[model samples]
Target: MMTHPPRPLALGTALMLASQPLWAQETQELAPVLVQERRTVLPSPAAPLHTRTALPVSVAAEQSFTRADIEALRPRDIFDLMETSLGMNITRQGSRINNFSANRGGNVSFLIDGVYLTATQAQRVVGDIPVGAVESIQFIRDGSVLSILPVMGFGSRVSSPTQGVVVINTQPAPGKAAQDRAQIKASYATYDSWSTSGSFRHSWMDGRLQLGGGYQHAASQGKPDWNMAYASDTYMLHGGWKDPDFMAMASVFINKGEREIQRYIGVLPNSSVAVGQLNSATWKYDPRDTQVFTLNLARYWNGQHTTALTYGRGKADGTAWYYATNVNPDTVAGRYFKDESTDLNLSHSIVGEQNSFKVGAQRIGYVQLTETLASAKPAPREEEIYGLYFTDEYRLTPAWAIDASARMDKKHISKGGDKYGADGSTLKLSDDTWTDKAWLLSLGTAWQINPTWRLSGRYAYSRTPTPDSITTSANQELPDERLSRWELGLDAKLHPALQASFTPFYYVIKDAKVVDSSAPKIKVFNADTGSYEALSVYTSAAEVIRKGFELSLKGRFADDMLGYEVGWSHFKDDSVTADSGTVETPKNRYTARLDWRYGPWSSTLSALRVDEYCHYFQGACLPTGDFTTVNLNISRRFEHGIKVSLYGQNLTDKRYYTRHKTGNGQTVYNLSDGALADVGATYGIEIGMDF
Candidate 1:
């Protein structure tokens, strides 16, 4: 499919208004309207003392993005935003779809509005939430900065802290009567895609109560192809009440969407890779629906001490089908999955002139059910987690500070029911219940050497529970995966307008889980039914080590009219279990952006680069090619409360393959079939207003 530019009429109108702002000015009486500014505005969450963790400089680094940055970039989705961020690796699988790894590599935790999203819901955070609903995006690369219970609650048991954490704060209700505000935004783009979003917050009862809601709808028939069509809708509602001694808040979010299932196509012998040749012509799609609700209550007994309680419930339903060729019969397999979870958390915090302390307890219950029609097996699993944590931060001198934290967690998982195969044959299940416990600790310090330079260091130990699907040693018992990390950094202010930082870190994981295709599969046969059932399994491997360094520079010139940020990273990961030399992710990545504003016109240009790597967990270890792309956004602010933008991605229209491999890596190899592909140059336009 050919790429298209933004709609001519929209582009021309926006440019005309920006160039001739005097002609568009109006002298009309205005009510109490919210004024929009062009600087990063940090979002302050409700009950910050308990909900959001205070980022300690010695423990981890923080990256924050605000509304001004979001509007300037005009991101199509979360994927777009992350793709342009520094030290992040984003691989595009399709339009508005991507897989990402931050810093070292593993699964990152996603928290919205200070409430941890369930596993099923967390997977969609990058693609489902509208930019209008976000007040700020904060990324913390160090797990030691927060309590282990929260980190583990949002992350899978099989993943570790090396994966990093992302906190997304949604727009809160207005806190003042006159500052109440509302907005509406609409955009149209290539491939017959469009979106509409709006949100508002109003305060009443003498600024003691607030209510707000937001809605977003986005749809696309990507590239006018039968295989590339999808649509989604998102809704958010929130309410808050505040008094001198007590504060309470509640929020609800709903997301429903469907998309054509995209599967990998193998490579062809001695041929070029292209989108048209990379997909199976299967007529199938996947549908999903998810909803989540959260409530928080906090009370202040004195100026220095406060207590808080929080509760959350979430549910998700999903179903999909695809044709599998690896099996003997090339069977069409359909699967259904369900997830439900509830969480309760209690915490207390005390603040003093030179010291602070926080203590919290948490409990989480989760259930997952999976049914596959092709295999005809229904497997259900339930998990419960209980944890206690405490943190202390203190300043020892004018130039030195220290902090420490400790946490303990107990986890239990139960497998339910014997699973049946397609022929009504049942396989006897293994042990029904598994229990594990672990403790984590972190210590760090920061020193200010001079007015322009500072140094920090931290050491932490954490653990990840092994899933039941993994095979144990000769004893046939599950093992808990453990991780230890050490990091050191230097932050410097070279000039009043420029800043720089360099961080180097290393971590290791014990009992790393490795997928072994050559290992024996589990098979069970019943004499009564004269049928057999088989299951796949994984084995434990030696220690896995990951080392990395991140460097960044930021500068604002010409009195803040011009701004730029550059980030570069290098990583080396090795798994002794895989027997392979290197991990499946890239070793080098870079991202940079330049922003310029003059009068009512503003623009941002960004670039990203990712090195080649193998596909992780695919058994075949397919090697992919390197990729680089550039994006640009330009917008004009009109005097009458309207702003218009024109944006384009991959302006050069480079073609790249998503998954690449010869059939076999250890033996004779040939181009495989059905490889996945990504899109080319795309463009769009947006218009928004606030009143």
Candidate 2:
């Protein structure tokens, strides 16, 4: 172990540090009265670098999820965990995966290691990724248009990706631990579900080189008779080398997951149609397999100059049940998509200066292959995207800072497939490629106001092309989406142990993709009859406007051992059509979490409440009921590096549906007889050992 002497701190730094939440500052505080007392503490087994709780204030309004938060919540999956977090809503349909939206009906995007995950098929598999390998999750509510534009312009449907960005950072290399350390955990829960996972980190050459790996397996008997059953296997490996002038890191991850789905069931038992009841019929399989590899290298020079290169490849293959008028509804089909990208970034800052600048360029390519059946001819599609961006940050004074950025992107899409005529003649689909281009600009400023208060505001504008989806055909083209947003925020330190924030925002998305269930049945030719039959399909509205405000408060007491967080969001999202109908956003939503720790025992109590909203059914708005759920968890740690935990989800045993979106992009009810069908109370216990 090595220790370094503490250096004198500046007055501004001291004031800023004092404004941070007590819970996040506890482990970093040190008092040095004399020269000998200046010795810093070395690495300890209880505190690992990869699990640090440091949260640097950002220009954008942000929320964070740390390892400590995860340990207390014991969520069943990422979606389960995020739903409990601030500013996120996930509703479960009849399948294992759920519908997700953030910031009160704003689009949400996901990224891993700064690499775009949503542009690839990997986005569909995010629900199955093992959280065992995750180090931290950050949700930037007001993303910079420069960063959001290229992603949206390329393929993402979010006209305003700036509204929400979820960045997932996996565990990094081992720290300066003297020897190898490891932990293993096993758990069982209601619904006949179980999981086992293990991870280990080791360092070599005085911590200059490090390696780590983790694996997890989980399975669950979702419902009766194996319906909606689920299972998954995931593995991750990471390696890194660091030195004074250069650093390199590499990581690889693979996931194989399977899920079962139950088709639409009517909300009423004796309604015009019967649906959603547990039946003896076998559930359809929705299998997903994903693999990703990423490498990052950086070079450092004197006087605060650095250059970095990053490259990542991600691929996903899966089978899903799609409604086909000509085939059995229970059948599954295969599809695959792949993404590759490389980026180069350069940044410079003068030593002891208050300004910084950064520039970056990137190129990405994606491929998709789809087939209705194993022997059917495949449809191949490809896209190429190129981007360039620049950002500048300047501190006008000790209490004021401002930033500006700009970005531009170009995307090209092409497809290859056979067009079959009714006379059995084959025609070549147009190989001519189409291209889209977009640019974005943003500006933001933050003022400390005083030692106990801060204020910030931002405005951004961007344009994005229509999103490409599995159902999109070669000839299906739509106009680009345009968006802009302005937000104002206030942060206040009400007390030494309490912190609060209030953010008000407004955004408009033109040509946005809003839920629309009014589309009539479409005709599809059947080979058997050489005739056409009409089948219902989902649809979407072209535009909308969203306005909202978010409030959050957190407090810590009892020497940072007891803490609580409260969050609330109110929004009004409406379509621009003549009807002026409200969009699928909750008018009011609230969340609360309380955490307490005494000696070796810790506990967490959480709750979520959502107000009633409108749902589209049969081309009409229906009242979707409001619901509330409470969850609890308790855990104890022993002296022998062993820990045990017990948790219950929906502890009140309340009956509720997570809410669902149908194939036609319309929100639908998932209840039966005015009660939940499958999502009931669930409980679990876990035991683990650290070495």
Candidate 3:
């Protein structure tokens, strides 16, 4: 494996090109197109309010990317978009594990058109969604109590406000007039990869009713000898109806895929201590499928009060193959896993002259089942969660306002089913039942000092339940994790065309969950070895603190033909116990993006820089150097609604690793991998047409 340090030359070159004045040439203005921009305002069970009214300054600190933005960036996937544009750091445990973490080893929740997905479900579906189907993506960092309502219907490890929430909307916009719209696109890139997608929408009855559907197919042959080939197909269907007093919508999404896991590269030999190694050459996931459905209904009364109801369900099934060694193909084994969940929510809201309030209640049922090739029966785990929440916004004065929210949740979990070893012998099974309760509270205030400047502050506290997967006989009764946070922000209009924001925050977590590798809690049968193996136990840490600040500046120039944005973020961690230190994450990050449009041509350039950090493994911290990468997209529109574009990623060809870890002594090997390093500089061409 090879690694490179940050390249100042690449950063400087990208900035220089962005500053060019080529867009200053005279050009004809194009027809105005209506773009829907909807922001989540209150804790409603239905979809977010479609009104254009802006949120109060105190709780308006959300970041959003529209469909137009996506078209200009041309990210390969959602994960790529988050890392390059949203300033989010992603960590993957391994290719087959499907364990993903963001920020500083924190869990982030996902919501697709008001349907919540659990962490496990998110891992399998987030990356599979067709990029062409996304309408908007929003990042709500304030941990607004309303944002957590979706997750409440589906319990998750995203307990703290610092983890944040990512809301993705895939529903197509309802045009103003009765019409039909359709588009199709195709793209081919490096590594013998290609993709094709098509979508259509039909609206009738004075634009009161709408129907749409989309399909996508993609395949890729990864780097030679890496055994990472992948392929997938996705389908979507949606319908909506709106009237003076009522609105209803429903959608269905399906995805299926298969891929071979990448092989792990060995660790650096400079270390003195010996570490475990794992052999994963024959590891892979074959025949995986996922399906999700959502329905929403809302009613308005007297234009001052509203009631809404939402229902959602999701299901996933997959098979994982593990071989004892690369040479022994005959020693292969398979494990099948299935996940299913359903939720229902009801909410009501009232508007007043000086005060606004919303209340909601929800229930969720989830189940997980797993079985080995030799097992007599599948092992099953089930969870039921119930929650209630309320939010209030009050105007103390024209220049001052206050907001508060509270939520309560209860969860019940049970585990059972038969277990068997490779030798066909019965194994010990734990049939346990447990109940947990948690709550969250938040308060915020905003003051408009003047027309150009606004100040806001907020505080939040919450308790998160432990995940069922990590629970064992030894720690099945562990206490819940507790977290608190404080944040302050200031927004300023520096100029007529420029705006800036600064935010500083402090966060603390107590009784954090951690795996105790040295303490084996239970013995699990290893099919390959035909014997029992001890598994690690879960424990709690005393405390950990994270302090960070974010700064951003964005605006348009050249009469709005050119747009630019710059952002910087920094974070520092303090752990009460060295063994419980935070995961490897950059202490500082810098990002910049420039979008230029001239006549029928449009282009976008973006860059990201990450500071060096250390990875903690086996009680040793190893340094991983910093790096920088740049990406560019340029497109041209032709007559008859035809369009063509060129996309380039990691133009600098900077090589860097996303994660560093030692494997199990016998089978798994040390590994380090990332996007640029996995496939090198990638270039692609895309063509599309609209009718």
Give me the candidate number with maximum TM-score. Answer: 3
lDDT tens readout by residue for model 1, 223-275: 64436677989999987887768888888888898866454444544533343
Residue pairs with clashing backbones, model 1 = 264-674, 265-673, 265-674, 265-675, 266-672, 266-673, 266-674, 266-675, 267-672
lDDT scores in order: 0.66, 0.63, 0.67
- The digit string of per-residue lDDT tens for model 2 on 1-691 reads 1234655556656676689888757767645332323222211222211111111123436778887787787776787677776677665554334556775565566667656654335345577777766777777666563352354533434343545667777755234433577999999999889899999988888777878889999998875643557788999998788776776888888888877664443455443235444332243445677787777776767556766666777777776544333466645344333333333333332223666566667676666654245555556666666777776657677567777878877766666344433233344554546556676788887777665677878887878665543122222455666777788888877785689999888887777654333443233554322334323222344556788888999999889898999999887877623232223667788999999999999999998887887654444444453778888999999987999999998886765554433223123322222222336689999999999
Candidate 3 lDDT over residue span 1-691, tens digit each: 0123333455555555556565632243223333333222222212333221113447534677888988887887887677654436765445433444444336666778787777667777787787788988877655444533532323224333336566787885434325678999999998998999999988888778888889999999976765667899999998889877888989999999987776554445532222223234556678778899999788877566888888889887888776534457665657787778887878887777667777788787777765356453565667777888777778777667788878888766655344433333444444556546677888988876666677888887888676544433333456678878788888876675699888888888898666544452245556544544434355676787878877889999898899998888777766523343235567888888999999999999998888887765445555553778888999999998899999998898875656664433333222232221334579999999999
Against the true structure, candidate 2 reaches a TM-score of: 0.80
RMSD values, in order shown: 11.0, 8.5, 10.6
Measured by TM-score, how close is model 1 to the native structure? 0.82
Model 1 ranges off by over 4 Å? 1-48, 90-100, 148-157, 160-162, 173-178, 263-276, 281-286, 323-335, 371-378, 416-434, 472-475, 516-537, 576-583, 616-621, 657-671
Q: What's the residue-level lDDT of 118 in candidate 1?
A: 54
TM values, all candidates: 0.82, 0.80, 0.83
The ten-residue window of minimal lDDT in model 2 covers 47-56
Candidate 2 error regions (>4 Å)? 1-60, 94-96, 119-123, 145-162, 173-180, 262-265, 269-276, 279-283, 321-352, 416-432, 466-480, 510-544, 576-583, 660-678
